[model samples]
Every structure is written in structure tokens, then in C-alpha cells.
Target: MSDRLFEHSSQGVSRGLSAGSPGSGRRLVVEADGGSRGNPGRAAYGAVVRDAESGDVLARAAERIGTATNNVAEYNGLIAGLRLARELDAAAHVEIRMDSKLVIEQMAGRWKVKHADMRRLAEQARALVPANPTWTWVPRERNKTADALLNAVLDGGPPVWEVGASASTPVAADPTGRPAEETAPAEASAPARGWGAEVGGATTLLLLRHGETERSQAKRFSGSGGEDVSLTERGRAQAAAAARSLADRLGVAAVVSSPLRRTRQTAEVVAATLGLPVEVEPGLAETAFGEWDGFTFAEVGQRWPAELQAWLADTSVAPPGGESFEQVLIRVRAARDRLIRTYGGKTVVVVTHVTPIKLLTCLALDVPARAAYRMELPPAALTEVAWFADGAASLRSFGVPAEVPEDGEPIHG
Candidate 1:
């Protein structure tokens, strides 16, 4: 029986015998678990090391990791487990069991550790156990012991341990573990972190495409260069529906819009309903189609087939005298940065045109620039993206109609 099992601290064992001590050759199994109530909210981890031969609990470690992602918490648990194992018997062969497939796969070198924070944590855990202990991914149900300990610590229960248990005789256990599936927030609404594991609330943007304009209905090119067009009557109705859908629901800190008339008109409706003023962002304007402005796709195809094909094939290709998708991305990226800086951790509603909306959606989804061509967002459709402190984005919902009710009741946007 390890003497270190009974002692406890948030950072793992506070007192322990020397490593590689007498009777330190026994194999060990380390099970670890971690979670955050709100994902990026309050977070903690728990780990338990046991004798592989006897299943006797050797040591337990847990700690509150403050605001962090679930991935970060999982890595912390692994680190704590490895540290506890080293204290008990540095030379013992250890098997690490965790429910996190990403952690296990990354540590095993089978999957790429793309996230910077996760890579750092994985490196730390590896440094502690230089030989790279056997990594195994178990289902959450199989890691009940550590899961319970984690929840206990999170619930403010003091860490306790029952060491020196009879290997063959099972004793009474205080298993108060809850399944992670039942406890964790659904992935859709949960704030996502970046590779750097951004902490704290995100700057959420409720991106809204403006209602249809005459140019849009006519299937003609409408760009910032053309005479700014207003919404049609149907477009006006769509804007009103969207405004009512979002006004009380998003809790918008500010309402921002494209400088163009169509977007401004849509923004006005939302601002008026929400009782918030509209801030014009020129960067959110439609693509500058230049000579192609007001021209139908068929007309452009017939007149400038080569140029049209080039523009379609490449994001850097612009119309005869206008901006490219790449250019739009650059300015939109800047706009996103400025907005996040101005309204960090607050929800902001952005009323803009199709190109900018698609570009922003691509950025949030972390896809290629060509992704804009693949997506179709209906007018007055609401798309959401939560930008974290570290510049990572969590795409919540996409193309949700503003005025549509799913259950016959008005839904808070």
C-alpha cells in the first residue's frame, strides 16, 4: 500500500516517499477525468492511480483549473495522474487511461496536436513520464472513479482517499460520479476555444444578412460601386421579422451594419426595435463588382467569359475594376478584429450583405476562402459566431430565418 494515497492537495500529493523506493516496482494504472461546467467556465480535473495487479487505489489527485476548455482540463488530469504516479514509484510501468480520445490520440502521436495549449500540456505530461506511458482511451463510463473525484472537487467536496484496501475484498465506495454526457453542455451552445485554449467569455457576433434588394431579386450584380439600393417591400417585411426575432433575444451590446443602403435599412429596423443605435462599418459592404455591377451572371458570362471564369476559379481574381474575395476577406478580417476589440465578451448584431456574411462565416468555420462559394445564406438569415479571446471562433447556428417560428411560438433569436 502506498503511503501517499491518504494525503491530498489541489495540486496533487503534498507529501510522498522518495521515488523508485523499495517495493516501487509494482505496475500502476492511472485513470483521469476533467470537465468544465460551462466549458470555458469553472473547470477542474481528477485522477486516481491504482495498482494494476490488485486494483488497490494508490493515490488520488485533483485541482481546480479555473476557466478553461474541456480539452485543457483533460490534459491537466493526465498531468496530475502522471505526477502522482512518479511520486509513488517513478520506475513503475504505468498505463494512462482517459476518456478524451483527442488527448490519448495526440499523446500517442497518432493524431496531430493542432491546438497550441494542448500541445504544451501534452509536452508537460510527456516530460514527467519521459518513456511515454501507454495511453488508452476508455469510454466515460469506464473512468467512473476519477470522474467522481473530479465532480466532488468541483462541487467543493474535500478530496479524500481510502488507501491500503484489501485487493481481493471490495469495500464500500463513495461513487458519486455523474456521466459527462448528462452534465456537460450540448456542443452547439457551448463556447469553443482555440488552439491556444482561450479563456473567458467570447465576443459573440450574431451575423445577419440583409433582406433582399431589387438588384438581388433581379439576379443582377450589386456591389458597393453601384447606386446603393434599398430593400423591396417583401425585403422590408423580412427585415421587420428578423428585427423582431432578434431584438430581445441576442442581448446585443451594439448593432453594426454595412454602409450600403440595403444593409443600413435592415440595420435600422433591428436597432429601432432593440432601442440600440446603428454603427456603420464600411468593411461589411458588398463586394465591389465594378464594371460588372448591375449585370446579370448570364450577361457577364457572355461578355467576359474568361474573366468571369477566372474570378470563379480564383479568390484573388476581381472583376474588371473591383475587389476580389481575398480583398474582402482582408477588410472583413480587420472589421472582425476591430469589433472584438471594441466589444469583447459581448453579443453584437451585424447587419451586412451576402459576400461579407459568407466571408465571415468562412472565417468562423476556419475553412478555405473558396468555402464562400459553397455556402448559400438566404436573405435575412441569422448566422452566429462567437470569437474567443485568442482569436478562435465558435460557429453556433447558421442561416436561421429571422421571422420563422418552429413551434408556432416566437423564438428569441
Candidate 2:
């Protein structure tokens, strides 16, 4: 494999022993695996290198990479394994074995790398490829060594090796090889952040409800299946007001929005003011209300009274041919997790609809899904939630009004 597959910066690149230098012409085997408990939560990776000839272990590496997806962790495992092999023998004929088919195929050039994060990781792994490298897909059972290492780390054991360290170095252990006191899980010694004490930095999400649509002004059910509505004049004014408010905030890293027209229009106003592009997150779109779309609550009650009652009484019940609260919760949760993973330690503005914003608020507060009904989200309102590395969330504000100037002029920060 060519070393110049990607032309990235020299920063953060690990360059090991040169080819034909010492520790050359050897054969090595690298096994790797990674996992996440909640898909994008509490992630880690493990990798082990072995002498191909004697079947003896050469090095082991594992680490807890907080808040990542399974695919990201797996790519990390591959990178760690490749790095270890390079340290042992840079010119070795390396056999890279991984349990993730996605990583394997992507690395081997058979599958395309899609996610931006995955593309970066694939590039790093490619840079570490040795001479005559062979990519192999192994079953999960055959990757037990690496899996065990990751599990041990996740279970509060010391990391086998630290990042940028050679194979011989260990981390978070004393001279006697016992885990250090500081290495204990935060919950064991420190009080939960939810109880009042602050821990590490958090990813703050500023959730902005979309501006007023015609349906919104009329108290109609405007969902994904309904007409793709544009922002009314009042909605445009509200969006402009929101944009002015957001422009004053520092460290506003990204502006994300639902794919629907109203949310996109609102997001565009904010993004343009903040000098950032709008990123669409489909999970933030309004719920599919099916046949109930574009109807008033009273109209729905008159037509599908049983369905509406079931949906209102039970979170799992769907409107006729529509999505259930439970279903929206699942998708919204996934999108929230992805945003947390992608924008950790940063502030992101999420422009979405009432249901998604309410769902996110419910999640941050650890309230029942049924509580969505109790929340009052007005048009172009803002809610703030901070998500920490340890999975604790703090609700900072809710339903803050987006104030417009009385003279109908643009409000500047």
C-alpha cells in the first residue's frame, strides 16, 4: 500500500521505525476490536500484536475513548494495532485482522468511507500500513484478545498502554501494577455531577424551535408528512431575532437543523449570522403525523378520537398510520448521541420542531417520555442543555423568547 494515499498534515501522525532499519523483515499479526455500550456512549478499543512465527504476544494496547460510535472505536482499534506493529517492525509483513467488516472493507478499498469521522480515521489507519500489508476479516470469537483488553479498560481496569507510547509502557498503574486511586471510576470517589459538582467540559446544545409556519400559526398538526411549509413573515422575523441572539454567543461551533423547510429556513438565518454552514440532521425533523397532518387537535379528536386518545394516554400508541412517541424517542435519542459524539466540548445550535426539542429536553431531564405533553415550546424559542463526558446532563434554560426589535429593524449584538 502506498503511504501517500492521503495527504494530511504531519500533525498527530505517528512515524515509527523506517523501512530496512532495525527490526525489519519480520512477520507480525495484529488483532483488533472495539465496542460501545450505548452505540455512541462509553466507547473503547483494544489491539494486540503477536509474533507470527512463535505465536507469542508482542504487545497489547487498549483505551477508553469516551462518547463514540462502534465503528469509530473499531477504526481506532485498527489504528492502534497498526501503530503497534510499526513500533515492533516497521518493514514487517503485517496481517491485520479485525472483527469489523466495515473497517476491513473500507481499508481494503472495496467499500466507500461515508462519515467524515470515519474518513479521517481510515486515513490515519492507512498511513500506518506497513510494507506488504494484508487486511483480513476475522470473526468476533477469533478477536477475543483485543476484545478482552477493551472490556477490561471499560470495566475500570488500567489501560494496557497509553497513546503515543511504545508497547512496553503502561498507564494508570503503580509500581506494583495495581490500579492507581485516581484511576477508579468517577462515581466511586466523586459525587455525581447531577447532584451539583461539575466535572469535565460539556457539549452544550442550544435547541431552537423553528419559526412560525401557517399551520403553526393556525394550531394545526404540522409534521413530516404534511405540506413542506415555508416560514411566514412573522416566522422570518422570529428567525432573524434568533439569529441576532445566537450571534452574540462565543464558541458557537456548528449550526444543525432538521431537513424540513421551516427548520431549515430558521437554521439558515442563524447559520448565516454565525458564519457557519447549516448541517441537516434528519432525526431532528418533525414526527410523521400521517393522516392527522394539517389538522387541528379538535379536528383530530372529531375524526380519530380513539386514536388520538390512545396516543395521548400511552406513549407507545401511534396516531392512525403515524409514528408513536416511543418511536420518535428512539430516533431523537440516536441523533442526540451522534451530536454529542461529534461535537463534544463544543456548542451547537440545533434548529428543529417542537416535538424533537421537547424530547431532547425530556432526555436531558431524565423525565418520562409522557412529559413531552407538559412542555410548552413556542415558535422560535430556545432551550439549552449541557451534556457531560460522564453522561450527566444539565438543563440550563427552557422556552427563552426570541425577542424582536419593536421598530422592525435588524437587531445587532
Candidate 3:
């Protein structure tokens, strides 16, 4: 959703007519609004810029953020509005109008931004403004246009645009008792500079491992060929915690999960939190452990010593009828490629198994298969990889866990 927001902003900032270019001395009025169906569910925001003197719409922006809090969505709207205003007129005196007192206060520096996500967004917004801009808190009634635009996008309608008075349209209020307005911008509004010249955009992956099952706690080899078990109560709690953390931090574009019960459940939790849906991928499933399913490592060593040794020694070696690390790497790579193509320059959460996660991480880091063995992935732990538009990859973090309550028993394997 952040990617979509950035795309819209990029187009508006990079290509549109400059306010100083046409109407050189007009004061700009920016009205913005953000909303969430579940306070953090089905989030979207809207912003519209107008010539304060003529009351003519200059440019408008809005997008549906996957899942985010009311506050986060509000901040996003503010950022979009300010960015649009900056792109529209570099020298126009701008006045921001919103119904969100929280955003007004915080951006005004009267309230401290504590959340890492909000703070990051705030910084991005501040970077666009070279000088102090006026901030105003208006009643919900006066902010209907922006509010309507937000609702329209959320309702599967078109985004806001810069509309001229001659091409004006009717404004509708949100049925849920919120003020609403739609916009139609009359001109192209892109930034003065190229959008992705120095650092090309990135597709960020938030990789997560599935939670605990009985086999996980027992230190057994559970694979896709084995019985697909659901997450335990403790695992569910861990997933919930992780969902909360991610909903707050990740402006996730989509949630993709392995086609396994455990992974599906975990992904569901996350998707619910983000107000997004889950997409299952067979390539993300765990390796087929074959004859070793549900067997302990020691048992596997005793029963299939030669196979075990061979498997550990070579990435190409398979266990009995099981898959090889190299094969796992192949499928995982394919999945990564598909994801990058499908969601380029976006942030995605991938719920998968340990081997897939490790292999994917290793692939992102340009490491050999042996690196997967060195990495230890805990149940519900998260790892992040950023893939750039120029084909470069970077590992942002690994083995990161959400702030979960100390109630669940530790997973063993």
C-alpha cells in the first residue's frame, strides 16, 4: 500500500503542472482525511489541493493502504497532501486542513511521535517542505471533500483528481456519518526530478516462519508430505502478537503464505490484522522429508546414516524420497521471482516454512546453500529482504520476533 501511495505521489509530484508555472501567486489550501474500517482495517486516505483565492481544485491524491491504524492512515493522507502541494507549487504558501487533531498536533511538533512507522512517515513528509507551513484543524463538516475521496477509494471508486470549476462534480458525504468529497485534477503532476534515478525503488519482503505444532515442539522432521497440522494454542498467541506488531509497522501490500495448514493459519492472522487477503503458493511449502517425517534427528541418523550424511554433505543430496536443499532453493527462487514481478516496489509478508525462509534469505544475501544450515529460524520469527528495481538485493534484518507475551512454551525444533 505504501508502494501504491508512493507511486501516486511520484506521478503527481513528477509530472504535474507547477503552481508557479501557471497561477504563479495563488495561496494553496490542502484538505486531507484518512479512515480505517476496524481502526486498523481496510484503511485508505484522501487529499485535495485547491487555489485558496479562486477555490479551484488544483490536484488531488488518495489510495487504499492495506491495513493501518486510524492515526497511521491519517498521517499518510497528510503526507500525500503535502507532497501534492509541494509538487504543485514550490513557492505557494500552503495551509493544511484536516479533521485529525492528532496529526495536526504531532506534525506541528507539539506532540512527540514515538512509533517507528509514524516517525518514519513524519520524516518523509517533513523532507518535502522547505519552510514552515500553516496547519489548521477544521470541523468534520468542512473537510467533506477529502473524506469523500477516501471513502470512494475504499469503496472501489477512482482516486481523487484535480478538477476545474467548469468540470465540477457533485460531492457526496460518507454514509457512515463522515464528510466526503471527490476530486478530478485537470493536469499532470509529477515531480520536477526523475522519480527513481539514484536509488531505484524496492520490493521488501517480510518473511515469517509458521508457528509451533506438536512436531515442532517434539523436535521431529515435519514436512509437506507429512500430516499438515494446525498451530497450537501457544502458536496462535504468537501469531496474534506478530500480527499486531506487523500491522503497526508494515504497510504491507499483500500477504502470501505456503499451502500448509500451519502457515495458512499464521497468514490469516496477519492478513486479518492488515485487512488484506492471503494468497497461497505451493512453492513456499516445506521440503518433503519423505521417510524421515516425524522422526527425530538422532533416529534419522541411526536408521539412515548414509543418506543423512550424504544429505548434509551435499546440497544436491536428497533424503530417501525427500527434496534436496538445491531443489528447495530452485522452487523458492521461482517463487521469489514471481513475487517480485507481481508486486514490484512493494512490501509483502510471506508466511512460509523454515527451509524456504532460510533459503530465500540466503538467496537474497547471495550466499551458498550451506548458509541455510547456519541460520536458525524460530517459530513466528521474521526476516526481511529488500529487492531493488535494478536487481540488487539487501538483507535488512533476520531472526526478528514480535513482542509476544511470555506465555507459550518454547518450540524445540
Candidate 4:
């Protein structure tokens, strides 16, 4: 059989000769694919819609769908692609392409969808397909864009794709996220100039630390491994104040937060003010403090003095049964890179905790891990970092406190 197979639907039968030909009404080409690390292990799907005439990417979507078979993930990609195309232009002609022969044949009505899950996903995909659609099967080599997106998500990166990104444009690699290597010193390269001085637009991350928790107020070691804590009343007020501050900033595309309750609560306030949904990013969670959680410095010193000293002195030393600063750096770096890739040239509010924020700031500055200790990030404070396309980062601001009004109203600014 040929490397490419095309199947035209009944509605496309009349227009098959010129389905995607020039001058057609908004012809779109959708390339989608899915992958599973263990066939039923971690899985993700990636899809991109491009303008057929210009070959420019119109929209991109990718998601990590927990554990699933490769076939399910492929169908999910098709569904996501169709949905994106429909959202772009309902009347446009959509040409759906995939590397999965099974998905292509099933979607083309050439094979039966025997599994219940497959049937449901297929139906959902079909429902979103435009009035007249074309199904095409292309070899894997032709579908690298979608594959890259899928792999990025499976590798502990965020499930986001840049809209209006070029089809041939490569996703930025994790330049500073490697666990084994030390981040390059910022001084090694030319200093970053003011905004718009970089080669391309920057991805601005507005990092907002979570509001005051009980443990935080007591100066305790509040980490992810310990009890999940909520924000205090003051914390809520601080979140609202921070939200008001962010409301004045223009062009914030989305609000993302750690899964922990304190950060989520803070993110909820900010997202509500911005009229955007809160996206949970697990990598932004605080470092796990294990047995030392909820303990003050004095207490930890009394209980496990040697361990505390070792942890304080080394980045790779983990607390008893908890994560090390090095581990936190790895995940936070992954999260930062994912955000940069997903929201290139856009602004995003990252609601997280102390360690992640400090680590991110340190990474952007290309400073050593120890620098995280020198920084002081108060609860609900906002820091800003701009990541350029060329792997350079600029630290715009650090630990700017929210201005809470005396009258209980949100202080805008």
C-alpha cells in the first residue's frame, strides 16, 4: 500500500476534486497523534490545526490523559483536533490526518471499532467533525509536530501548545532543567536588556506565592508531604489583594497553580478576577519536608540537628522521606519550560509555593541552587520573570507585596 491513504466522506464526494485546493473556504489541515509509554501506562495526545494554503499553525492542543492504551489516546487526539477545528471555523473544510492506521481506518469507516471505549471516543470525534471532512493516513515521519507535543507532555511537561505557532517551529528544549548538570551562570552570557530587546517575544511568568497558612505564620516547615493546609483568613485577603493587582496587568492569558490547597485557593481568587480558569500544575508543589514538616527551625534542629544541617548545606540532601532541593529543581524546571513552550510571548500567573518560586527565580537567573536560600519570598508576594525564545531569561521583579486595603475591598495596583 502507498504511504498515504485518503478517504473522502459522502459530503466531501462532490468537493473531493478541490477539497483543500486554493480559494476554498478556510481549508484546515489537522495533524494529530497519541502515544503510551507502556501501551497502557502514561499516555498523551497532541494535535495541531494548520491553514491549508499558508501551512501556518492556527491552534495546537495536547493533554496527558493519565493511563490509557495507544489507540484510545489517538482517538482522543482526533477528538481534540476536531474540536479545535470546529471552534476555529465551523464551516471550514477540515482534513484530518493521523499516523495511526487503526485510527485512520476506523475513522474512515473502513474498520470496525470493537472496544466500548473506542466506540465512545470515535462517536465523540465524529460528532465534532465538520460537515464534510477528509480522513488521511500519513507515515509517522510526516507527523513529527504532533509527536513532539505528545512526548513533551509524557516527559512531565505541561499539556499546552502555542496557538498561531508555525508548523515547522521547534518547541524549546529544557535548556536549564537537567538534574545532572548545573545551570549555566547568568554572567557567562551577555546581560539581558530591557523588555523587547531579546530576539523574540518573552513568556512572562508572574509568580504568586500562596497566602498565609497556619504553618507559614508559625514559621514551620510546611511541605507537600505533610498535611495539606489551607490559607488563613489573612491569606484569603492577601490573595484577593494580589488578584486585584494582577487585574490591572493586561494580557494575562491564564492562571496556573500547584495542586496544594493553599496555592489553589490563591489561584482561584486570581483566576476569578482575570476571568480565566485555574490550571493545576503538579510540578509547582512545594518540596516535601517529610518528618520535619510543621516543625520550626529550632524544633528541627533539636530533633534531627545533623539532618537539618546536611539538608541546609546541600541541595541534593532530602529530608527524612522527603524530596531534596535538587528534586524540586528538576520538577520546577520542567514546569517552567513547559509554561514557556505553551504560552510563548504571553503572560501567565503562576500560583505556587516558596520552594518552587525560589527555585524558578534562581533558574531564571542561572544562579546556583544555593541562591534559593538567599531569596526571601513572603506569602502572596508576586515575582516576575521573562523567558526569551533563545533560552535566555530575565528577572524582572522579585517579592513585590500585595497592597491590601484597610476597607476590605481589593486594592487594584
Candidate 5:
């Protein structure tokens, strides 16, 4: 065994240790971090342990795992750090830190992990320590070593130990380690959004598209210009019918709507049944179809075949004076952030357009914007998003129940 691992190594033998010395009742400090390039892409986790007294690191670990999420990576990190601490059988306690809020929350019992992948990962992480330890959720800024280890795995670097201060068998890091870097400044405060606001309570948003409009029936492109378009008689009946069907099921706390007349009219019907006023969210407006506004599908496909093709293939393509799907995504993301930030953890009914609804679906699916064009939204439709506090969002339901018919008809919306 290394002399430094003994109870009476000279201070010179463990000069770098800062937290504690090599004696009984000493505590351990652990830092763990995880990363995935494409998120659900290639993933890795890393962790390191330093002697409390001499401040010298004792052991280093990193693992390249199969495909996993950022949360999965984080759990693996916790697992790695826990295992490292376990190897030091005499250590009475450990102070742990990580960058993932979900891991911190789930481990802290403040959030529920419903995904099978995360559930398994969480079980493994719990297997590390005895289900409890001193832990904190630090931002990416404070976690340098573990973050570096994760990056090393992602950057095509050699195996985990190729760079860290790990070479000889259980050796001391140095007589005096390079002075610790200045501690990162504290991050500006940000209130929790979505699910993490409360312990075990998830904030859910019920997203519903507006009822049919004249443009919807005509199959014309309706953008910002159709702000004043009124719903047809059929549309009005559809909204009222949907309201009656949804009222008993969705105990909506608030009714939020787009500023457009069609959307406002749709909101009125839903609000009437739910007994809530419509709060206008201007950011959730539909795509500005520009010169393509009021043009039927056949007209656009005929007159602007090349432009239309480009728009379909590439989300950035704009038809004459209209907005691209990318623009719509940016705004809808802002709208989602705002709503989740403002009414977090509460069920809010968002009555809006097809494009915005599809955007929410896309965000939940985490797919590219081009994929939105492939989404089909029936009028007066219902979709549900369970927004988690960890900045993670989930799609629980899409397009309402198939049994939900349009108006009196048995055809589903």
C-alpha cells in the first residue's frame, strides 16, 4: 500500500489534500458528470475521488455505455461516484455534486422518473450508496473534472485513465497538487419550471387547436393575416361540442389563447364550458404564410412548386413573404418557455393553431422541424404535454382520444 494511504503519512506525503487527512472518520468528496452529444446519442459518465486531508485524488473512473439519455448518463455518473466511495470502506460520509437537475431531483425524491431507461439507471444509481448521501445539484460551470471526463469520452480521446492523475497502483497524486482553481462564481438564480416546482407533482399543459375556420375548410394557407377570420357555423358547433366533451375530463385552471379571432372564438367556447377567461399569448400565433396566405394547397403547389418543394424539404425555405417553419419553432419554443415558466406545474388549456400545436408535439418528440410538416392535426384537437421541472418535457397524449367525435358525428377528431 502507498505510504500516503496510511494513518501517519507526513504532511509532505499528502501535501495536496485539503478536505481531510488519511485517518479514521474522514469524509470523501465526489464530483460526477455525464454527457451525450446528440442527447439520446452516444453517452458516457465519469467521476473522481480526492482524499479530504491531502487534497490528492485517490481513484478515477469513467465508463462508456450503450445509447442513453442525458438523465441516464447522469445516473451512471452517480453510480460511478457511489461505487468509488464504496471502495473506501472506512469513509463515513461523502459530499456529492452533479450537473443534472433530474438526477438530483429524482435522487432527492422530488421528481418521478417514468421512463424505463431512466428507471433502470436510477435503480443502479441507488445501488451505489445506501439510498442517501450529502448531495447538491451544481450547474455545469462548477463541475470541471467529471465534465472533462465526459467530454474526453465524447471527443474520441483515449480511455478514461489516459489523462487523469491515475497511473501507479493506489498512489498519492503529488506532494503538493497544482493549486485548486478558483471556485466558479455562483450562477444567477432561476425559478424551477414545469415539474420540479413541487415534490412528486408534475405540471401538465393541455394543448388544444382552434376549431375549423373558412380557410381551414377551403384548405388555404392561414397565417398571421387571417387574424380577423371568423369560425364557420360548423366550426362554432365543433368548438362547443369539444368544450362539452372536455370540460368534465380536464379541470383546466386557466384558458390561454392566441390573439387571432379564430383562436379567440375557439377559446370562448372552451372557456364557457370550463368557466375561465382566455389569456392571449401573442407568441403562439401561426406561421406567417406571407404571399402564400389565403392560397389553396392546389394554388401554392401549382404557382410555387419549386418554393413549396423547398419549404417541404427544408424548414428554412419561406414562400414569398411568409415565415418558415423554423421561425415558428423559435416563437413556439419561447411561448412554451413562457407558459411553463409562468404557470408551471398547473394544468392550463392552450387554445391555438395547427402549427403551434404541432410545434409542441415536435418539442415533446424532440424531432427536427421538417418533421412537423408530417404531423397531421384534426380541428378542435387535443394533445397533452407533461412538462417536467428538469427542463425535460413529455408527450402523454396526442390528437385526443380516437373515440372523441367531431360535433355530433361519431368520427374522431
Candidate 6:
């Protein structure tokens, strides 16, 4: 529904989710709700940003999350609200209220993700904020907007809503109530950016990074010629966790990988999960590290501190025997262009290494070169970015999802 419908006096003030002071609330208040019909069945999430006191929506987000459980859907809703509020204003202190108790406790560090998928997703949510985006648990009654949005998502929408359904105290479901909301998949709230590809013509690349490698495991510098060491035991576990999670969420799609074992093995994990083939893309390989290929961080610092510092300080600088960040970016960019030209709008999984994923994220976010260096990816973690026909891109998620728990320490990652 066009949220603009809430902008007029013509429609006598319907009881908005706010009571006496939503608009005037001191902090930005985020109310998020999500639901799945069969736990892991069809689901959707909705979130609304209220000014706090006077209960006016500064922004609203709602969408179908495909088939996920209520908990996953709820986390998606919370993360969406957190991210929207951040994009709208970074410094704005937000008081996020959710109807999911699991999210509240997990986000509060009271729960450990016994489930691998949930653990990773939990991490993704943590990365959404600059730091402490203040999450709270509210009674179902208080989260009316998010609830309504979720219900709308559940019913498919043929849109249970119209442009102006008289924004009264939003039609909340009676937890036990049946909604009269329309039923069809709600059209996505016109993406922030456009991807003008033919219907189903846009090639969607699911940019994935390999799980931990021996280099990553040993905190050693790893690059293109590191002999393509395979994923360490934990790396294998991370990749498997990711594969199972992706299989549940995105079902399956094409799988492509760097021939390097770290990535090739990662691809195999996902391929096994999705019953897809692993297409090797040599162009997707990690950088050729030349001389310092498998050196430890301490070794690199002791021997090549000057060179390392210069490269870190400037992406244009190359390692003693490795390619410059810019060079990697160029090759990855070419590979990406080629993929898009080939696949268009279809969602395909691309399992590769860190530099390429972060570089692609930087491109999508339109940030500077130094910014790519600032990204922090996890072992067997996942991030998503989308590119459009007009050359615009958006970072759907960077690093990993909060499906897994973190150290409760706030991160700038």
C-alpha cells in the first residue's frame, strides 16, 4: 500500500497504531511483526517507524519473506526496521519493539543459537546497526502496525489492503481473529532502486564467501596462489550450515564457484544441498598472492609492514607479490558484468572469497575504496548485494546475518 495514504486530513484521523503521542515519542520507535502460517511455511514481515510520541510513521517496511518460520520472519522484520531507521538517519536512537520473544532474548544475549541457521541470521541482524540499536519486546497489542503488515503478508494481499483503507487504529488481527485483508502477494514497496530487466530477466547473483580456510584458520595471509587449501573442519561446518540455510530459504538455484578448493568445496556443499551443479568460474578465484601467499599476519607485519600499511592505506597499492585491491575489483567487476549479461534477473549463488564479496558490496553501496577494507566478514558467512540495469546497487546485507549469536559486543562491521 502507498504509505502516502497516511498524509491527508481528508480521511478523518483513523486510530493509527499510535495513541496520544506516537509522533512525539522521544526516540525513533520501530514496531516489527512477522508470522509464518505453518511455522516454516509461507511468511512475511512488516515494520513501521513511528516518530515515537505522536505516533506518525516516518517510514514503513513490509514484504513477503517467501517460506520461513515465524521466528525467521520476525527477525527479518526487526532487521528491516533497524536498517531502514539507520538509512533514514544514522544518529537517530531507535527503540525497537518486536512481538518475537525469541528475537528479544537472542538479541539480548540470553540465548545461544543451538540451530546453525538461526545463529548466522542472528549475526546478520547484529551487524545492521552502528551499535546498540536498542531492541525491546512489546506486547502484541502495542505492535499493531507490524502485526497488520505481517498478516497482510500472510494472506498474500491481492492485497488485503487498499491505498486508503481509512488508516484507523490499523486493522489488527485478534491473534485469534480472521482478517478481511486482501489476499495475493503484496507488490514489493517499489525497490529503493530499480532493476529494469525483462520480467525474470535480471540475473541475481548470490555473492557468497568461502568458509574458513587454513589461512583464515591460522590467521595467515591467504591469496590466489595459496594452493587452494580446502576449508578447515569448522569452515566445512560453516559451509554446510550455510548450504542448509540457503536451501531452506532460497530453495535452490545455479551454483558457481572459484576452482580454488576453499570455494569449490563451499560450492559443493551448496550444490549438494540444492541438488545443483557446481560451475567453475576461474575468473572468480582469489587474488594471486605472489610471494606472501600463505604467510601469517605476524610474518607479513614483521617483513612487509611498510608495504602492507601502504596497501591498507591505499587500495591502489599492490602487495609485494599480490594484485592491488583495484586490480581485483576490476576483474570481479568484469566477471560480474559477464554474469549479469548471461543470467539477467535470475538468482544464482556465487561462492568465492572475501575481497571479491566486500568489493562488490562497496560497489553496490557506492562507497570509497578504503571502505571495502573496513568490512568484516565471518567464517562461512553470507552477505547480499543487488545491482541494477541503470548501474545502481544496494547492500541488502553485509557481513553475515544474526542467525548466529555474537559476543554481545556491538560491532561497526
Q: Candidate 5 lDDT, tens digit per residue, 100-200? A: 76776787666898976576567656656532255566667657667766665455432232112331133222334311222222221122334535344
Error of 1 at 207 (Å): 0.8
Candidate 2: C-alpha lDDT: 0.77
* Each prediction's TM-score versus the true structure: 0.52, 0.56, 0.51, 0.55, 0.53, 0.49
Best-matching candidate per TM-score: 2
Local accuracy by lDDT, each model: 0.74, 0.77, 0.74, 0.78, 0.67, 0.65
lDDT of 2 by residue, 269-370 (tens): 999999999999998889999999999999999999888887897664667777767568656866886787689899999999999999888767655567
Decoy 1 TM-score against native = 0.52
Better of 1 and 6 by lDDT: 1
Give the per-residue lDDT digits (tens) of candidate 4, residues 102-150. Answer: 9877877878999866776786677677765767778786677788777
**In terms of lDDT, which candidate is stronger, 3 or 5?**
3
Write the residue-wise lDDT of candidate 6 on 214-258 in tens digits.
778787777786576877766777777678667765534588898
RMSD of each candidate relative to the true structure: 17.8, 13.0, 21.4, 13.9, 17.9, 18.2
What's the C-alpha lDDT at position 393 in model 2?
73
Q: How many clashing residue pairs, candidate 6?
A: 49
* Candidate 1 lDDT by residue in tens digits, 1-413: 44542344332221223224344456788898899999787777888888787786777765555567899889878877886777567777677878888887787677898875566667667766634256667778778778877776576543322222312232225344443323433342224444545568889899999987888889899999888889987788788888888856755799999999999999999899999999998888899999999999999999999999988976656788888785686568658767876898999999998898888887776555677888888888999898775445778888887564434333454
Give the distance in Å from residue 52's predicted Cα in candidate 2 to where it truly belongs: 24
Q: How far is 131's C-alpha from truth in model 4 (Å)?
A: 47
The residue-by-residue lDDT of candidate 3 on 163-198, one tens digit each, is 333223334345564433344332222212224343
lDDT of 4: 0.78
Q: In model 1, which range of ten residues has the least summed lDDT?
A: 162-171
